[model samples]
Structures are given as C-alpha cells and as structure tokens.
Target chain A: MLIPFIFISACGADNANESEWRTLDLNNTVLLTLPQGKVVIELAPQFSPKHVEQFSSLVQKSFYDGTKFYRVIDGFVAQGGPKDGSEQDKSVPLLAMEGQFSTDGKAPFTLVQRDDLFAKKTGFKEGFAVATNNSKSGWLTHCPGVLAMARSNEADSASSHFYFVIGQAPRYLDKIMTIFGRVVYGMNHIQAIQRTTVIDGEYAVDSREHTPIISMKLMADVPKKDRIIIEVENTESASFAERLVKRRARASEFFYKKPPPVLDVCQVPIRSRLVKLQD
Target chain B: MLIPFIFISACGADNANESEWRTLDLNNTVLLTLPQGKVVIELAPQFSPKHVEQFSSLVQKSFYDGTKFYRVIDGFVAQGGPKDGSEQDKSVPLLAMEGQFSTDGKAPFTLVQRDDLFAKKTGFKEGFAVATNNSKSGWLTHCPGVLAMARSNEADSASSHFYFVIGQAPRYLDKIMTIFGRVVYGMNHIQAIQRTTVIDGEYAVDSREHTPIISMKLMADVPKKDRIIIEVENTESASFAERLVKRRARASEFFYKKPPPVLDVCQVPIRSRLVKLQD
Candidate 1:
C-alpha cells in the first residue's frame, strides 16, 4: 500500500547563489523514448550508492531502453521499469528492495515532516520517491521527477521496473521500495499523455495483459549534436525559493483564492530552461 | 495557466460507512472513447453552471466525439478541450469565465475542509469548473480529474477547449479560467497515455510542431459493453480521516530521512474502485 507523505518545503526561486544554474551532463543522461517524445533523465549518483549502482549498471546494459510507464496514477505516480520483457530479462531474478533511507545525518535541501508526532522519520530528496531514513541509512527521496524501483506486495520485490512521481508525494510507498534518481528535464513529455480505461475486463478483468514497450535509449549513445540542451534551476538558489513561495502564496491574478501558508515539497515549481548549446 | 490542487487525506477506513456510497446517475455519465480504451467521465452540475451549459450542449451535439485529449502533463493533467476542432465539428464560440463560485449556501458534504482557510474556490463535482469560498461563497475547485474549459491568456478566453488533471494539482491557474467539469471515472485511461515531445525543433520552437491531441468522445456515444465502470470512494468516509492522519504519519521502513509535519488538501488521494453495471 502506498502512503502519502507530507511535502517538506516548497520554495521556488527563493534562493540562489550568484552562479547556481548549470546545464545537465548529457554523457551521464538516459533518454526515455516514449511514443510521443523522448524524456531525458539525469541520474543522481550523489544520493545513494547501492540504489544508483543498480540503476547505472542496468541502464548501461540497456535494461530500460524499451520499457513502458505502464501504471500512471494522477496526483501520485507514473511507473515504467518493466520486468515483463524478454525471457532472459525476466529470467534475471529480481533484487530485494534496498533500504537506504536513514534519519541520523543532515543533508542538503532536506526537510522532515510526518503525519503523527511519535512517528519519527526523515530522509533526503532524490526528487520525490527515493528517500532515506537515518534509522537505517541509505538514499532516496520522494520529490517530483524522482525515479524508483517498482515492486509488488513485498518489500524485497523491487527490480528493473521503475516509476516516476507525477502527482502528489506518495510517501507511503517509501521504506518498502527502492528509489534511485530524478528527471532534471523533460517531465512535461511524460506528463502530457492520454490514458486508457481500467484494464480490468468489464471492471473485473482476468489475466494481466502483456503491454509492449517499443524502444528506449541513452542520450550519450546519440550524437552530441542530436542532443537537446536543457538546464534546471538550482535547488538551493534564492530564485527557486522565491518562485515557490510566491506560487504557494499566490502570484497570478487569476487566483482570487488565498492558498495555505505553506507549500508541499512535491508541489514546488522547479523551473528548467532550455539550454541551446551551440557548436 | 493551470493550477493543481492535490489533496492527501488519511484512509482511517475503519470508520467508513457503507451508507455513504452513492452510485452515479447513468443518464448523467459521459463515456469517453479513445483508441486506447474507453473513459467514463461524470460531469458535475453542482460546480459550474455556465461552463456545464456549454459542455453538455456540446456533448449532445457531438462536439467532443472526435476530439482528442491534446495536451497531457503526466502527473498533473490531461487537457483536451480545445477551441480548435476538426473540419467535421468546427470550433464553437468560447465560453466566458463566469465567476459563479460566489454562490450562497451551497450543497454541503459531511466532510468539511474550509476553502476560506486555503483558497476561496469551488466547482461542479459532476461536470463543471466552479469556484467558491464557502465562508464567502463558491466556484471552481482545482481537484484532480476535473474537466475544465481551456482559454487563452485572457480572463474569459476559454472556449470549447478543455483539459483534465492527470498529475499534481496545479492550483496556480485557479479563478483565472473557467472550469467546466471533471472526469469521475476511468482516470487511469487518460493517465496511461504516452506523452509527446517536440520533433522538428531542438528547443521551444513552433507551438504547432508540438504534440497535437488525436480526438476525444463521450463513452455513452460508443459501444455498450465497452463502457468503463467506476466507483469513487466517499471522501467523507471514516476511512478518509484515518487515511488523512496516517498519510501524514509518514511511518515507513524506507524513509531514511523525514521532512517535517505538514499536510495539504491537494496532497490527499481521491479513492476509487472499478465496477461494471449489470445489464
């Protein structure tokens, strides 16, 4: 069962050092080729060791080059890592869910929130789903664009199947799964697809249907000129904090409604600029 | 402008009452047919009057039959109400943004989460974009799955163009545009669509080169058995309170770190179940 986590802090365009903005490293990026467009995700090796290890190794081996984001729950998540591939891919045994989140140490851009007071828990933000609790330290945070391994009913069931948080923070799925990285760009590409009715036959279908994923690739594999340049607003920048606070406080003339005093970490509007890198 | 309002409520399902279950009126349900599958959207007249008038009238006239959910934002929204239509239907005169949320003494749900505490907005639950400040009044609520009118940057620019919330709640767009209705069923269908990207240009280029929606339609206009069946869990249920509290608890094995103790209405999950009506 997925548990919804409170957004830690959402401050967009609020803070910025003089030179905080930077472009993505395409050499280390993976291109999620969807039917509509290609989604470029820059993995984070700085967060977790084991989690990133599995992700990098798999991506290098072309593990998710063709998997589809099969399950998409609005205000929640869009999952893609697929084990439903070739006989060999499926033949590879799934890995146990990595427990990386720990609550002991302090990290950057990290804030902690819990529904109940007694329930002591905290972690860093990978994006939205990859979180780490110091109680037993690892890496993973549930922020938008954060990617994690998808699993079934068991905590140890996570594998190549991965997903993205496209909605509110579903922190409930936290300790139970392994979250690895986040999408620094191309989130809109995944956000704007059409949907399908319940696969459940007549609202109560039988067996699961085998969905097909055509192809996926890494930008590094493509020619440098072919790459689309993109840059994300630095998280620690004052501008990002300002943008978020203004958004949470109400900036548009259309919003006659006064919003709550705070913003959810998942609700933060992180901006990404199209970096036109010329030859 | 699009505003997302993701609400996260605790399940507290233990206190849920069977009596709270309410079936949707078949006559009022709109079945959306797409190549992917069938989507059922129940328009709520309780939210917006002016927008619903134009919407239902359009549905009856088959305005959206061949329309597609043009722009989809993966965890945010799937918008398809476009003023631009195919040669067959042609575009209809856009509807002006009617500030009707200022209604006095609106229908009351057992659960009370005051908008005055947050934003002064409300909308049609069946099929309308409404806004309201229960204390002051009511109109369009940016809850998830809501089908709203799409307009230009102008205040009253929304014509027949519309969109649906597929991901996080975009509350920033509230009150600026007119919300027509919401999708009550088969949200998964619209949520599963693959997102599109810019093909011709490298950066933000011509808007037309952007992905275009194929078409959209009401399911009632399609095959009989293909219609998707859905059941929305009562938000006012006892389980809701529990879910609300637990959701805030953030007690999990994975959270190596936790943010803080905070919760927002938009972060809440709107529970649902699939059911096929017996002939």
Candidate 2:
C-alpha cells in the first residue's frame, strides 16, 4: 500500500526553440515589490490602452508606493490601491469602459474550448485567457492571476484602484470588469499576501492587517543592474500549440481515467521564466 | 472620480425559513484544528463509504494529530499526512477506488448549469458541487475547499494521505480522484495556510516551513461544551433554488454590464455559518 501522491507532469519547455518564447517588453512590464517578494506583471496595452496607460503612468509617478491591499476576499479577489482622499487621487480622471473589444478573425487566437459556459468560445490570445462571442467580440476571462480595474456601480468609472483574481476563475465578472494585465511570474507571492479576515460576515477594515506594497515601478524605470528578465511562451508558437494538444489528449500513463478532451482556458499553463540580470 | 468598489450582494439567508437549512449530523462531521483556526468538514459517507469509515476510524485514534501539511502547492492542493513510515502506518489497508457512483433521478439536485465543459450536466447535491453524465452517474467536483483522497499512479493506492483543493477548481481530476468531504466552515483558514515556495522550478521540501496540524476530532466524540454547531443551506430547498435563479439573472443594479444568463457550478455559493457552543 504505497501511497505516493503524484501530480500531472507539467508540459516541458526544455525542447522548445528560442522562437517559441518572447521576451517581455520593458515599457509594459511592471515590477511590483511587496513585502514578500517581487511580482512581475505584463500589461496588455493592445487590449485596454487607456487602462494600461493610466497604470503605467501611476507606476512611473510612484503612486502605488506604501499602498495596502484593503479588500481581499478569499476565493475571489485581492484589490489594492491608494484609498486616501488626497488631492492627487482626486485629480485622476475616470476612463470610459474598455471591457470588451470587437475583434477580427486575424488575432493569433489559439482555441481551447469551443463550448464555454460564459461565452461562445474560450481561448488564449497574447498570453491572456480570452472569451469571444461568434468570433466578433472578445474579452479577457477572469482567471486567477488576472489584473483588472475595480469600479463602482457605474460602468465607466474605473480609475486607479485595481484588483487581482487570486482564487477560482470568477467568470461571472468576465465582460463586466476591464482586464488589462496578468501576473507572468511570482503568483505564489500574490497568493501569500495576507488576507483580510472577515469576522462574523463583517470585513476587517483596520488596515493594520493588510499586506503592504513597498513600491511599484515599470521595468524601464528600474536601473539596468536591478531588473529581472522575464520571457513567456508565445501562445501563437507551434511548440505551444503542440503542448496544448498534448494537454488535451492527456496521453500520460499516470491517467488511469482519461478526462474529456476539452481544455479550459484557465487551465492552459502559459509558461514563464525569470532570469536575474545581476547579483 | 470617486473609485468606490462594489461587490455583488450575496444571497440573503435571513428571509429563509428554518426548514431550508440542514443541521449537519455529528457522526459524519470532523473538526480539523490548524494553527490559524478550526475547519469544519462535513463528510459524505453516502458517496465514499470506505474512505469515510477509514477517515473516521483514524480521527478517533488521533492519527492526524501533529501532522504537517508538507506539500502545500499554491493554487493547487494542500496534501498532508503522517509520512513517518511507522509500524502503525504500514498496517493500514489499501482501499478500492470509489471515484464515482451511480445515481437515480431521485437524488435532490438543484441544477446550476446545463452545459459544463467536463460533464454532461453540473449542479449541487447535498450541499456539494457535482457533475453528472446524463443524470445516471455523478462525482464531486474539485472546487476550492473540497477534501479528496490522494493516490499514486495506480488508481486504488490511496490509504492515509489526503489533500484539499485550495485554489481554482481542477475539473480534470473530478472523476479520477475520490472526494469524500468539503470544508463547510472556516475556509479562510485553509486559504491562509502556509504555501510551499518553489524556487527555480523546484519545490522546497523543508518540513519547518510547513503548517502543523494540532489535532483532528469527530464532533460527536467532543464534549457538548466544545462542539460547534454547523448549519448548511439545503440545495433541495425552494429558497436555494430561487437564490440560484437570482444569481443567474444578475438583475441587481450594481451590474451595469449584465453577465451572461448562465452560471458556473463552482461560482454558486453554498452558505454556511458557525455557532460556538461555548465561550
């Protein structure tokens, strides 16, 4: 009775060619330094240009320095930003909603599931999980590690406050929230962020328990000697396509009961690696 | 530009009658005490009889006391048990696989989604998320807080070690693994458990970083003064059905961009509350 717990083998990237990987752009990459570790985020400026621009400008200005993850709901999201009613906060303008955008059939979309519960189709595009309706319009799915803007009751009211999907994929918030980026590396640190303990159905608002954000800076702003180089598997590459096929097939001997030959967009592992440029 | 974040209002349990809730039976309840807090688990003996019996017997003998959650993978599972190859550990019998069970149409099921990616139908039964193949055979889904048995490559090798789904629902393992119970209360404590940091694609195997389990006990064996009363919303109740309808509708004013009129089985909330019997 040898009970050796086994995990499904992750797709190997060792055999992948250099063309299968794409180095993250310094202009769009953000280095979010928390108390635990550095969380690397890659912004999708092509999808939500305004939101990415706003977030990048804030990073450049050190607007997120000394902020706290104020509202963290377990199995839902971890939202954080400067909530102080300062003059700078008052000056930030509210941008119009960019929840979903119309897409041509030309985007490098790799299909994962044709029959998703929330949309007509679900897949990955530019390393982001996406859902589309009739291949005409698409929006990023609310998978774990997704970075989206938080808003009030009004639709077009997202400003500086942002949230990370830290648990199960809240697909209900798919087309409603504006998703602009995702954590390409150090998702473990995001999960390790201290959660706000809700006592008797009431959220603890005493910010003392919240995890602090030491600083957030764009990779371009960081000194050349201190940057961590990140490279992600290109979703459009042939090697990635092959890996997706292998995942859907589950051809390993470990699986005594083969699962359905359908892949959830969130389950698709977009592999990434971090290289420290200097000591 | 007031960025006030708003959350979807949870289904109200205040208006429901007492009949709509089901008080858990003490015989099948387990209280797993961790350093952070106590987690209340409701075992489903009807699904996996052998596994439940084995687990109950172990709880009575304090087999899980002082065990460390050695393999806590972020966004995956927290696997832990006494791996210290003692004579008692070698004496445990290997149990046959009870991954799924046949079902008649008589089971009290509340339909949540008709089109799930992995199953023909998905819904809730006896307060647990379930997926069925043509309403004939069903298995528990691997949603967050689900307690399941861990085994090796061989299907029927599970004995003493167990794991809990701590993050996104891994639907692929739904039918392959045997799910015996779910965390009905204090899931926050489960989410707050220390995670094993994987450095450079290698998992840290140090035992010191793992969270230690204080003890596990059956609620029935505990004295009346120490028991915590747990009541879960009945999935078969009319109020719960109505709540599911409201969740699918997104009729609240807060949702300016109403989501699709479909629900993911994992997104449905099965509310529970804890009542301390003594101070």
| Candidate with the greatest lDDT versus the true structure | 2
RMSD of each: 10.7, 9.1
Residues A185-259 of candidate 2 have per-residue lDDT tens digits of: 878778767777553433455778799999999998999998878888888677888899999888887689899
Residue B218, candidate 2: alpha-carbon lDDT: 97
Instruction: Please give each candidate's TM-score.
Output: 0.66, 0.88
Q: After superposition, how far is residue B223 of candidate 1 from its true place, in Å?
A: 7.7
Model 1: CAPRI class: incorrect
- Residue A59's lDDT within candidate 1 is 68
Give the Cα error of residue A208 in candidate 1, in Å.
Answer: 9.0
lDDT (Cα, 0-100) at B141 in candidate 1: 58
